[model samples]
Target: MSSTQQPQPVLNCDDLLELIPAYAFGLASPKEQQQVESGLTTCPEATAQLADYRRMQDDLRESVPQIEPPPALEDRLMAAIAAEPPARRRMPQVHRAWWAAAAAVVALVFSNVYWISRSSSAPPKAPDTNSHPILVQGDSSFVLTSSREIRWVRLPSAQKNTDATAVLMWNVESEIGLLYVRGFPPLSAGKTFQLWLTMGDAKLSAGTFQVDETGSGALLFNVTAPIDEYTWARITEEPEQGSSEPGEAVVVVGEL
Candidate 1:
């Protein structure tokens, strides 16, 4: 395995990922949020992966135009729910028919909840922006002493991807940033992912990450200069130790 292999652990990482959809949607409870934040330290790449999921979800939602249901959608759905009464006694064995009916019941329940929540006309409030990210490396950690500025920039184009997605979240004051990317083809052995922060004639290595089997990767790294000082950023596949100057092809790029 490469030294850059995904960091050892992020607690119950599978469980944490399952919670990401809720976490990103702001539907997670305070306790769940805390659980993610506390364990998110073990693998900052996982946190970046979570961000990728959030962006994908938002893009999916945006692409699917909203279609209002028929006026009777609510009333008809309610009647169908009432018609199917619950089975009072536990069965020794469940059958296929029973499973089908149970699925319908679950659907009805979620439909009701969705409609109720969407009843409000007000747009959702934004997450509080006056906060900083805590970056942890092993036992030591630091809350970014950053100015109250965070930038969420989507990498608009990729040299190697026809359907890849990447997003960069950078804190200018802290000189630290996290990047998450999905859909790039896995590289040949001996290659690794590296980030580049560029100012006119100067370039600095911001961070590096190892891609998993799924060809998704992320990194949290120290930026050498303020975001405004850099005109762009990039992710490149280089030798395992990475390069001071980009050696391999750049896979993803974005404006700072």
Candidate 2:
């Protein structure tokens, strides 16, 4: 009997866009990177989007400060785990239900003991307060605070709007940032989306982007000046090549 072979799944433009960020960052698997490269040759829109993402990746590498983790961090963590009581390390071979109950109790006791010890020890050093707060959407509760050199902000979708989502991660000190967007509507021919960094009355162009059928796109740009200087970021509809100034058509707006 002859057996039929199953066809492999084909990635569309939207699928390729989703992988663009990873590809540009060299985080994509070899197969995925090859697929993105192949897609770029066939899709002009994907090609343009890849170019922008590559530029962003380059800027991110140059601008973001890299610091090695404390050498003793892992050793300390391992020592702490080793210091836990030997009784806690030994688990009785009981029935499944009894095992679950015992596990829960052990977890509670261990956590309480660990916290108590930590509280009695020397006070930990304070984190850097000058880190840039990444505000997602308009919600202040979801802010990401980093003690490291870079500060990342994940922006949420507009109120009552389920159509799109965006994330902006950057190191204000390094003057480098990356914006990844998904679920925005695809533009018509001869039209594209433009990103603007608003500073008081002045609005500077970050770069332009185009989404796939599923509304996914990304942009990487270097902030020549301090990010604090820019108060707002917004995406607007513009001509294919983009415009010097933002047009009246606003797609999405976010506070920096």
Candidate 3:
């Protein structure tokens, strides 16, 4: 039997250096954000670049003059409010001692109505199905639901490929998914492909694998978090030991 080949370095220091500004500004994807953080830990030069960007942001803020609104603005606003119809204006004054007490009651009523309307108007949250027991099949495939309404996500290649294709099928309720890739070049020495799940500003690793000589690969991952919480899945090339963070070399991306 043949041994598995190790992954090679696909991205170098210079490539990561170019991504620092985007990473610092929170414009980079979660995977890229992880890469920047990892680079900062290993490379002093990347760390200095990050510090420079931070200092520049601070300097930009300091350069702007802090302007305050005029003190009379509040009084003028109150005068306008007083001029409006009673329905739009502040409540009429009761006896001076009781005014505060009456105002508090009005505020309480408004607060209750506001809360009731908000509760009724807002959409209900999706149920969390992660706690439910999963079902496994004889083929080793499992699903979260008996009906198994699977969502198919087509992953776009970083390099345009008419022949290359990748897809992910997952049940939002089950959070169990499979990734299939075809017509991708096998990794070079010291390089491996890693998968990531992105949720808002955070990214979590799904796992890693290599393609066969035919340029085909597959991965089965059980999402630990609720599937609704994640936004996308991404694949990137990294070194044999694998990266704690993703590199700039994105191979494929699929929206969740």
Candidate 4:
């Protein structure tokens, strides 16, 4: 259709102009043409205003500027870039480390053989199962906290309101179990540490508990479903009223 040809209107120009918004909005019916004609008789100024607006819009569409991006855009971007420290000049990929590693392995093998020979030559050492509880004689115990596992060597006797260490081993049976703590930080008024078993669709609450002045307390926790379920265990600080769900930072966590 030519631009000059107005869409074949059922209403006259005077009637159509009056119904411009509704007509422009495609809402004018053939029966409403009389009412539209009556409106134009009293509102010719509105028609002129709409015409002026349409002309201004057309002019703007043709005149809007489209300029190229500034050359400094590249310079500005480059200036913002921090030159990465000479990539640490990757150490030459030679088999030198492997050779060193091979040498260490040889030394370890020789040392192990020598120790085995010495042990076979010498008599067996006496057992100390009380202080060191392990299935085997030479096996050592390591303290594993709620956070992460740590190799326990010589730990000082635990004092009240202080961290304590102990040999903790998780049996595959209890995927997540309680770490009844003692000699640790006491809970502030109206707050407690909550344990969680994040295994399934929803987090399972172990229990909301606190420590006493002696720092003796039991944190009740259930392993995730399926008995030997692999789950991430965590402890979070919660309101004294207790939380229906987890609502604090994870104070401790460990995989079981």
TM-score of each: 0.44, 0.41, 0.44, 0.32
Task: Estimate the lDDT of model 4.
Answer: 0.45
Regions of candidate 3 where Cα sits further than 4 Å from its true position: 1-141, 144-148
Candidate with more favorable, higher lDDT: 2 or 3: 3
Q: Per-residue lDDT for 73-192 in model 4, tens only?
A: 988777666553222112133533532332233223222211111123332333333222111112221111222221111122222223642111232333333244434466778888
Please, what are the lDDT tens digits per residue for candidate 2 over residues 1-256? Answer: 2222222244788888888878877899767776776676556777788789878778878997888989999999899889974331111233324323322332242322111121233323322344222222211111123334334444555423356666555543445555667667678889998888888899999878777666776655565676656778888889999999998877777877
Candidate 3's error at 203, in angstroms?
Answer: 1.5
What stretches of model 2 exceed 4 Å from their correct place? Answer: 1-147, 156-162
User: Residue 146, candidate 2: how far off, in angstroms?
Assistant: 7.5
| Candidate 1 local lDDT, residue 64 | 87
Writing each residue's lDDT as its tens digit, candidate 3 over 1-256 gives 2222222233457878988999888798666766665566567787899899999999998999898989999999999989973331121233223322322322242322111111233313222353222222222233323222445566788653335557665555556665667677779999988888898887788777677777777665666776556788888889987888888988887776
Off by over 4 Å in 1: 1-133, 138-148
Residue 221 C-alpha lDDT in model 1: 59
Misplaced by over 4 Å in model 4 are 1-171, 174-176
Best-performing candidate as measured by lDDT: 3
Candidate 3 has its poorest 10 consecutive residues by lDDT at 110-119
Write out the backbone clash pairs for model 4: none
lDDT for model 2 comes to 0.59
